[model samples]
Target: MDTNDLPFKKRNFANRFFDATVWDDFIYRNDDIVVASYAKAGTTLVQQIVAQLIFNSRDDVDVASISPWIDSVYPDKRSKLNLLEAQTHRRFFKTHLPVDALTFSDRAKYIYIGRDGRDIALSLFDHQNAARQDAPLSADKTPPSASGLKVLAPTQTSACDYFDTWLERDGHPFWPFWENLRSWWQVRMLPNVLFVHYTDLVADTGKQIERIAAFLELPLSEGRLPTILANCSLVSMRANARLYVPHGAGLWKDDGRSFFNKGQNSRWIDVLPPEMSIKFEKKAVMELGIDCARWMMLAGPVANASVG
Candidate 1:
């Protein structure tokens, strides 16, 4: 494909949590790795995995600090750019923006992680609750516009209600879930984009890590493999949770450990009613089509696994 022919469309999106406009000022490097996902879709996990691969599985590395969320308005565009510009390593950054809202670069490699929306809804509930708890403390200290931070008020009382709101309203407290998934799914065939699923990662982390490493063309020695796998494990990530939590422990309800809460899938299996589950599945099919929806729901073999 012609580099110039690659799709590029600028858009503006803002909510309490994200400012997609931050990408407007982002400077992309040829070797840059962009990690994109909807909320609570194992974004941090992928970032941890990428950081481990780039750093050759160094346990002490601050993954959160090193892999900054460039689109976050907390530190502002100038501050993020300054930090990114000074980075000597192959830089990887985090974003939750949809494809159109971003400035696409043919040179950069993008890793897009997808999780079942049912699972994401449960995880998002905990995340929002934690943020609400932390909001008051930082409300006076941190300027509102600086972070685009707003304490997310719970729209529903229970997990079932929360899932209903999430699916019906389309990723309430964040952006539209369907659009975000569909936008990235459409670009899965792009050479620079790698599609990852949370279920697949959980099923075989080492295999997924190898896939990621190969996609990024990282030279992995047999000796370094064990360390990389070890560091990216759920236990290790949760144990060293402070280093991986965004904006540090102070911004979380339970001092950041809660941010890494139960990296398990199918939690919604018990929580959501059968009808609600059926509703979500139907919506998924409507938004993402049968192939992508099935792939996303199962997180199994990719339906269209042609991209490098």
Candidate 2:
């Protein structure tokens, strides 16, 4: 039977059961590396890049299968544990759960990816908008709208609320992005943990990929490195997303496009209003120790703020 065709119940147990099972039980072989990132903070991009670094060749290799998003609300705890226990190869699992919820094991290398929160906020907005209208139809977390454009004002919810609300309160399955980012960021100094910035990845995919490869002790062939970089490029990945997104496993309405949207930094340049930008900047500095002036320089000047 096709693994993709498995009964929905058996296929996705975690979401179905919700009775948190022992996730570690699925480890067939212990891996020295784990890549954790906030939603759309280049999680899939990093996964594909890491998979290529370790395997050297993408041929006949299903990148999705190798870097499975285990914590996603599909595989029940027992099933998840079973899968983890059954795997013998070095693995690279993906997760967005806060660190507190993660079951830590010594020796595993953990890499966390963080982006400027403003970009993250915009990405979340776009992603949420897409999910509301997309196929397989996940719940629409968007606030009701009269103009047909979902509007989320400050009075509504937080930057995290865009997806966290759907995943937790509405029982959508992915891990919460903000909590997960904070959880990992807090302990990034740990010997086994590495923190990567999304902007860094955008600025230099090749360099960042090498950094990740070295962290995992994975050797990349001379020719293989470039190939991997090209394949995981935003354009290529989006063009060939079927190889990565889980839902694209079969020939269903899956587009070979990547889940990654607007790979550029400062996409918030087009999305955030001046007042909201100030509010977000102040919040980020207060909450993340990231100064607004410094971050704005990184994200690019706010048009209104600069003039006034």
Candidate 3:
């Protein structure tokens, strides 16, 4: 994959990290909204949620077009700024880069999604494999330069390779999961931005959708709220997956299915080995301060007294 295609801005760890020159035109306007997150963290899932709410739950709109992905790839920097400047009913966009790469528009509201690293590992694995399947392959099913360890394309590798790389200490496309969440977690406390958890969305999509609408201050008619809630559910989103295509700073091909996968959480319990689970848990505790091993304390299988 060509690194130039990524939408990331070049930066050295200095000068407080500002580069408005690249995306000045694409900065948020009064009507613009941002659905941002780390990859495999439900960026598309919440984009659909917001889109449905803004469109008044209309089924006729081309969601993908209405909510363009303004990442480093789609419109590039110049085109992205151009899109940001243009007027529309609302400007909806997706992003996977961390907060440092993003431009904070004081007036624009940002919605960030957070998910478990285990599910992210699984989802990312599937995402990479799907892309590799689309690329031209050798008889043995390897890309041209990726046959050996020398080639380090995310799209050219398997799930295990991606997971290993992601879990490692220092590598390109840095995991930075811990730092990413903490930075945005801080931003979330700001008045304009909202932070959402993926598990909550899965468990109670309806309520989560309502919370989203409330955050955006988008009014929802009584009937429309239910409609948007139903449409944005993982089941509904997966069934209508064809409506969303790949766009962004990555080479995910144009595969629409890439956005909506197994949507279930805690899948690592099924596939992750004992040793790997321990390592992943340790890293999560160290990096995210959440112990996957004992996360059940908050997410037990049993219903709480209120729900029960």
Candidate 4:
């Protein structure tokens, strides 16, 4: 519970897209909320959920501007730090870096979201493909140069092939999946950190939200659950994509529906080769051990379904 026991700054993480060093300069507040995830693992969905909770069910919470990716190596990145320092509202934001790369604070609450590597490969393929087609940075879109990493063009024509490269390269052209997943897994025992699975969020959003709300010590207003559930639903988010897509990166499409693609789990069942899946299984277990890996990909007891 003390700062000394929190995850330490063990290393720096940077790619063309993320810069963990950006966090070194960030000053922490007691009530800050940090949403951490390895890319495309429902980071934004939780952001949407948190926004609804913090704003008391009002639907227009501009999460994009308000919940900037604190560690993004985006343009004017330092200015974001300045802006965040100036914010007076109970501030929250997102980060794609692993726990080891971040400047953790005992006073701040942390939420980490995880998804199966197989599903992430498919989702990430769609996400990157859409980015290549888009040309502007609205309040919602991230520019090609944002992450500090070089632009990675889609090398594969299909999601299955993409999965092969993703598994073989370990999140190639983006970032390392195992390291990021493992780093967070190492800290799962921390009292200040909360892990959420993408499947759990999609399977029973109401229960998940209640868990997240409770973790952040937010009291659920009577009858607000329905509104929170409705707003955070994939259908609702896709229908009102503009509102949910965070600033610097929402969707490049005019409809923004591409960002929320399917929102269902296990889209990789028939798509990826079974052999490749076996490889991912070994990697997940090797990287995160069986217990953490199971809780992350599936959900339930054995750390299976606890929002804690």
- Measured by TM-score, the strongest candidate is 1
| Candidate 2 segments exceeding 4 Å error | 1-29, 131-178, 249-258, 290-308
Candidate 1 runs further than 4 Å off:
132-134, 143-147, 150-156, 299-308
Instruction: Quote the positional error of residue 261 for candidate 2 in Å.
Output: 2.3
| CA error at residue 308 for candidate 3, angstroms | 23
**Model 3 poorest 10 in a row by lDDT:** 299-308
**Pairs with steric clashes in candidate 3:** 7-72, 25-81, 26-81
Tens digits of per-residue lDDT for model 1, 1-308: 57676767667765656666766777788879999998789899899888988887889889878788877766667777889999999999898888888888988999999998888989988777766453645754675546455455434478788879878899875668998888898889989999999998988988898899999999777788788888888788878888898777676666677677788888877787777877888778888898888877884222233310
Kindly give the stretch of ten consecutive residues in candidate 4 with the minimal lDDT sum. 299-308
lDDT of 3 by residue, 1-308 (tens): 23332234444222111123454345556746888776677787788878787777865555665565564332345555655566467878776556656656666788988876667767866765554343333212433422222112345655555666777842234345666665565555566678777788878888888888888988876777777766776677655666664432123433445456677777766666656656665665565454322332133231122221
| Candidate models: Cα lDDT each | 0.80, 0.57, 0.60, 0.76
TM-score of every model versus the real structure: 0.92, 0.72, 0.74, 0.89
lDDT of 1: 0.80
- CA deviation > 4 Å runs, candidate 3: 1-21, 136-162, 169-175, 248-255, 290-308
lDDT tens per residue, model 4, 1-308: 76666778888775667777777788899889999999888998899889988899988887877788887766556778887988998889998887788888887898999988788888888876765443332422445445433334445577787878888887876788888888888887898889898888888889999999999999997599999988887788777877766443333555666667776587777677666666677677777888777776673222212221
Clash counts per candidate, in order, are: 0, 20, 3, 18
TM-score of 1: 0.92
**How would you encode candidate 2's per-residue C-alpha lDDT over 1-308 as one tens digit per residue?**
23332211112222331232334344434455677766667787777777777666563357665566666544334545555556666777776655655566554678887776567655765554433223333212222321121222222444455434443332233333344455575676666677788788889888898888787778865777778877877777766766776534222233534255677787666655566666655544454454423432364564445321
Error of 1 at 263 (Å): 0.8
